[model samples]
Target chain A: MSTIIPFGPQHPVLPEPLHLKITLKDEIVTDAIPMLGYVHRGLETLVSIKDLDQMVQVVERVCGICSCIHAHTYCMCVEGILGIEIPKRAEFLRIIWSELHRMHSHLLWLGLLADAFGMESLFMHCWRIRERVMDVMEATAGNRVIISINKVGGVRRDLSPDQLRWIAQVLDELERELDAIKPVLTNDYTVKKRTVGVGVLTKEQAYELGAVGPTLRGSGVAQDVRMTGYGAYKFIDFEPVVEKDGDSYARTMVRFRELYQAIDIVRQLIRKLPDGELSVKVKAAKPEGEIVCRSEQPRGELLYYVKGNGSKFLERVRIRTPTFANVPPLLAMLPGIEMADVPVVALSIDPCISCTER
Target chain B: MGFFTKLLETSRVKSPWIVHFDCGSCNGCDIEILACLTPIYDVERFGILNIGNPKHADILIVSGTVNHRNAKVLRNVYDQMPEPRAVIAIGACGTSGGIFREAYNVVGGVDKVIPVDVYVPGCPAKPEAIIDGVVLALGKLKEQRTAKDTDSLAAELHQAREFYANRADRQVVE
Candidate 1:
């Protein structure tokens, strides 16, 4: 006679105000518990009334699908607290708009995990190829979806060789319409009977509940903060896409192999296209201390910190994000699942619950 | 049985579903309403769907800009959807409360709380105008299943507050 439901701070396949609580016994889940301060948006008290250029639009409004990795990690923590340089063609157009906002946020989390298992044609073929990478990030950053195109001392949009040969001919029509929906989403036998080996998450419970992205690369850690090279992911070159099982179809084959490793790092960032000046001016003044940057967002490792202190404003800012380190590995993969696989194992850890209640 | 209820009404007319709901802007129409459902505007060949409870939706989109702390969770997600539901709303900050129209923590649009039917404006409303506002909310869900007495969420919120108080008393008569 366990009982105790509570689902969310509001409930109905959730709309943020998280609250979990679970403990069923009848419907199965015997334990679950979560609760976060429903959108505690004081956002570290607007870093003392904004300044590092309006605190880069309050760290790209925390997370509209990782707002360009929180304005490119608050311009890499105010260019590592004002040392500023960044310009190898605005760090490869901020790694082609942060891997085209990580292949449109892992095809908008595989079309909300195919509209949460009800599949509706693989959720309209993964949001119709994430609208050709949100129309190549709204025709090269003029805002089609917060393409504020990260700025401070770099990136605010450039790519022209006729927009990198129309983004390599829309990456060969988005790799032939993402290879005609990868056999209805990775060999569809009803998406492998609703994500095979369901929600498991192990590699020592994803490194003791700190799983991030592809649910910590589907539990086998080949961790990926773009191999910590930050912007222009240290002159392109890829790999980190791992998968060791830890179930939910190996975190849906590690986000379908990081969407072919973000379409092969945007085809090697449009074949190493680098000319000059994407943006580099920064002189808005008022910045003094603390840094901490980090990137890899698209549901993982976002970090930010910031601090500064001279005048125009900011004196403290903090953001952790990647769903706040993937909520203690989504409450350790929600106690042996069941109650209708607890919202597809809490949407296989793609719970950006507006980037963990901002 | 009416041809197997006309093949379960042609597979629920290609599968409508949908549910969404942000109702407090600045997530940019919640990432163009999850990029109009993902592989780049694949409105599921018109069988559009995003369902996540709301009594198995048939569309109810609503993005954001309504405030006073999410207007009672946007009128409890339009009273937990179900009946011949439709809604839509979308952006230009869920239509009207754009740039947080003089924010004091906004409460502007989302049709002041519910009764929408299809707006899909912009400042974050593209994904092919959210697949032309979900194919004009599935053609106003075929004129709301042939209207047999409809308006009720408290008589459509007292006919949208007496049509916005007679358009604010017809702008106090020109």
Candidate 2:
């Protein structure tokens, strides 16, 4: 005989409200089903009321952790519709800010993942390193989390030479700090015990279920949206980070390795910083076509579909967030695991419920 | 006040255990709330804990706008907490629904479902600002404690009167 249990809407383990109905035979889970829409605000429907220019701010709030990428992708979509080629310097600036956002976002996830398995000290240490990233964002872009730096044509703010130098110095410090925690996060006995071989989604399963970001990369799939030469990415040397193990530990390592990759990308972009206008003046231009743009968020792939009908207001705005894509793989990984391991395995995908529901 | 009451009041101010509920926020404010617990802000120094259980919580720290579905869940959480509790609504969404006020499913601010004692206003309120809001909520919690003590006494007297009146009616029937 099997028993059914409801896990969350409000659970201590979950940061956001995601209810999962689990069918358990004794201590082992047999089936799991996710119920969403708790945090749904119908953000896509707001395009009717908010104009194209104003939608930048609206889209930024879609997911706070990857807010920069949302606005970056949205602006790219609008720019595509308008056929506007932003300045070289503006593209590099977007890269720098978005990479910083990636670093901070990865660190935040690492901390939460540690917290999931009851490693309180590790959680604290991970967040402590993340504060420096937030400090750099505030110093350069003004706000901490939701920095509205991206406009349709280009970026809104320019980093001064002094600020760029200071960021380089801070990145050096952050690199050193991250190195200190590397051994504990990767090689520690307890961390490995909890995460290793916990939620194994093979390459085939990941591909079939549409897993994106680290979830797919962890399963030995060498797929990343950044592989497509978009924006300033064409000018830089980049590779998608991948691991052969299809388990929770591999996913953790994927994000941890991406932290270093983000730092390297930011440093390269800063050294090759071009001199040009920050943004081009668009003289009363209204987007007249449908355009779809995709970018790699901290979690995974973020796709934005924007439709304009020769008007200020966009006809339709649809966002496909990474967490939404990763949910199927999450449900697939849950069954056959012990009930106690549910939180660690569930969090392994780095489920951002707000992004999923939004 | 007795010695025990004084101790209770002092402990209430000394350590305010908080339960945070995300009512459809973009997570900017939620991260800021979590940042308060980290080393840099280290709100634990002030004896505050983000204990996720509502039953043990003395203060409810709510972030995000209340939506159609989660409004019931928010109210249920608030009801579970012991009396003489305080509620702090963080961010512009939690305060007045901010940019998403016009969204079809959004029910505006946290105050739409539960009584909010402190409102920390920001697109995503800073960790320092969230800490300040918690300090303010503690003050409100202390006042509520005193008010509850007096209110409980009046409730006890009314219960005694009702019991005696019921007994007198039974005697007349006999």
Candidate 3:
């Protein structure tokens, strides 16, 4: 007889509430089913009440870790409808801030992953490095997690020469600090034992199940939304980090390698910093079309679909967060593993339930 | 107070185990709560521990707006905590539902479901403010230790339930 267990809605391993009903037989899992809507606040319906400009703030709150990308995507959707091209400098600044957000978000995930595996000291060290990125965000954007710097036409905040110089210095310090902890995550005996060959999602399964971000790349797929050249990424030189193993270890390595990629992208953006106005004034013209915009978030691909009827309030606002797409892949990976390995495999997708539910 | 009671009170004040519940928060405030435990903030210096089990918890830290579904779970977790416990509602959503207040599913705030001892307000309450909120909740925990008794505890539960009932009625009227 198989024993059924409810994994969450309030489990310690999860930072957000995501319930998974796992069927187990003698410590081995038979299947896993996810139950969502715990963090749902009907944010999509708020588009009816909150105008386009105000929706930016609401969009940012959809998931705090990827707030910048959410706002950036929403703004991109609105800009697409309005048919306005943002300034080149604004594009570079947005990329800088977005990349910083990505770095901090991945660090947060890495620390959580460490804690899940009971590596307390490694968790602390990862968070310690993440705090540096948080400091830069707070100093530059005046808020740590949800910066709210993106506007429709361009960015609201501009970095001064001194601030830019300070950011570069911080980046240098971050690189040295990350190098110190990199080995423990990649080659440590305990880490490899817990993560290696666990929760493997084959490349074909990942593609069919619609896995995004590190989950897809970890399965040896070279798909990254950043490569689409939406914003300043077109000018930056980078590749999506991929690993063939498609296990928990591969997912961890994908995020770990992406940290350096984010830093490199930020460095390139700073070097190619163009001189221009921060924003073009958006007139009181109503957005009159439907547009879908996609951007890469720390978790994975973030898509925003906004519909407007020549009014201040959007008719419909639909968001497809990365975590939502990753759940099916998670369900696919859970069977045939011991119950103890559930947390390691579940967290491998960097499950952001709030983003998924919203 | 007897020796055992005095010892228990002292230990409770010295080391408070916190159980965090995320209601319907967008995750901004939830991360801030997590950040408090990190090295920079290092809330462990205050003898605070974040635990998963509610029964083992001395204080309940709730983030996000209390929505229709999570309000029941939030109350269940709050009820599971031992008596003389305190609740710290962090972030604007926890305190007053914040940006999602107008959203249909939101039940307004944490206080709508359970009594809150401290309210730390921010869009996503900063880590420093969350730490300060925990410190403030510790004081309330101490006060509850001194003031609470079996009869009064029962009375307070009734009052809390009645308070929620009345608020629900008022919301219906509005």
Candidate 4:
């Protein structure tokens, strides 16, 4: 007999509300239906209320975890429409903050994953290492989570040489600490027991369901939006970390490896820092065209479609957060797993409901 | 307060077990709530345990605004908790709906549904502010058993108790 379990609008392991209707045959999941919109704030429609310039603050709040990138993408879209040329130095600065934000996001996800699997001590250690990156962000950007540095033309703040040196030192410290914890997460008997081969999405299955970020990379797709080189990726070397096994463990490994990639990208951007004016003056312009912007968020590809009239307020602002794209794959993966592993598998996608619902 | 009630209040104020509800919040407040549990913020130093179930929770830490769908669920979670419960609204959204205030779906703040004992207002309240808010909730917990919000729900719960008592008396007479 198959029993239906309403897993969550709230669960201990989950931070946001992503409800699941799981049909179980004995200990195994027979099917799962995901329900969203517990966090549908109707933020997109607010574009008309908030002007294009003020919308950066609104977009940053779309998902606090990936706040910097959301603001960056929105600004990039506006810049694209206005055809404003941002300085080279500003691009480097944007990459520095954005990649640092990526590290914070991944570390947070790793810690949450550990917590979900009941590895309380491991969770503590992951979050502890994560704080080092947050310290750098808070020191430079003035806020730990949401770094409001991006403007339509360029970034607001410029880093001093001394500050750059401090960031480098912090990066070294972060890498050293991260290396120590990698073994426990990768080779630990317990983490493996829970994550290895838990939620297997074949490479083809992943593509068809429109999985993004680590979820897509875990299934062996070498498709990272960074490769297209928006912001600073054109100047810096970039590559997507790929693992072909396509299971929960594979997904975890993809995120872990990307941490190193993000660190490397930061290093490259720092080395190639150019001397130029921070921003170009705007001519009191409003966006008069529609444009779509795509950038790599901590989760995956975040796309924004902005339609602006000659007025200060935009006609429409539509966001397709990575979690929204990745969620359908959960249904494909959940059917065969043990009922006990549902939360772990669900979390493996690193679902951000606020991003999706917004 | 009676001797036993005072003792209960003292103990409850000392070790507050919190059940965090997300409602319709962006992940900001929720992550900071988790950060409080981590080594840096270490909210556990104050003996605040982050629990899953409402029945065991002493403090309700809500991080989001109430939307149409989850409002009832939020109220249900609050009602299920034992007396001496404290609700700490942990972000600007939880307090006044923040940036999402004017959005069609938002119903303003967490206080719109249940009485918020302490409102820690940050776009996504900082970990330090969240810790302070929880500490402030301890003061409120000392004063009352559960929230004495002037709501129909509280009156209904009170009337149900009286209705059960009267029914028992009528049964005895019959």
The candidate that achieves the highest TM-score relative to the unseen native structure? 2
RMSD of 4: 3.4
Task: List chain A TM-scores, every candidate, in order.
Answer: 0.39, 0.99, 0.99, 0.98
Whose DockQ is greatest here? 2
Fraction of the native A-B contacts that model 3 recovers: 0.86
Q: What tens-digit string does per-residue lDDT give for candidate 1 at B56-131?
A: 7788787766666667766886797776778888877677776444545565777877788889887677778888
Indicate whether candidate 1 or candidate 2 has the larger TM-score. Answer: 2
Model 4, A1-358: lDDT tens per residue? 9999999987888888889999999999999988777888898888878887789999998999989899999989889988887999998898899999899999999998998889999899989999999899888888877778988888899999999989889889989998999899878998999999999999999999999989999999988998888887898867689999999999999999889988888888888899898888876777889999899988999999988898888888899999999989988999989988999999999999999999
**TM per prediction:** 0.31, 0.96, 0.95, 0.94
Off by over 4 Å in 4: B1-6, B145-174
Residue-level lDDT of model 3, residues B1-174, one tens digit each, is 468778988999899999999988888888888888989999999899999999989999999998888887888898899887899998899999899999898889899999999999998899999989998999999988677765775787799999998896677553
On the 0 to 100 scale, the lDDT of residue B75 in model 1 is 81
- As for candidate 2, its clashing pairs are none
Best by lDDT: 2
What TM-score would chain B receive for each of the candidates shown? 0.32, 0.87, 0.84, 0.80
Q: What CAPRI class is candidate 1? A: incorrect
CAPRI-style quality class for the chain A–B interface of candidate 2: medium
Give the CAPRI class of candidate 4: medium
* Ordered list by lDDT, greatest first: 2, 3, 4, 1
Candidate closer to the true structure by lDDT (higher is better), 1 or 2 = 2
Candidate number with the higher DockQ (3 or 4): 4
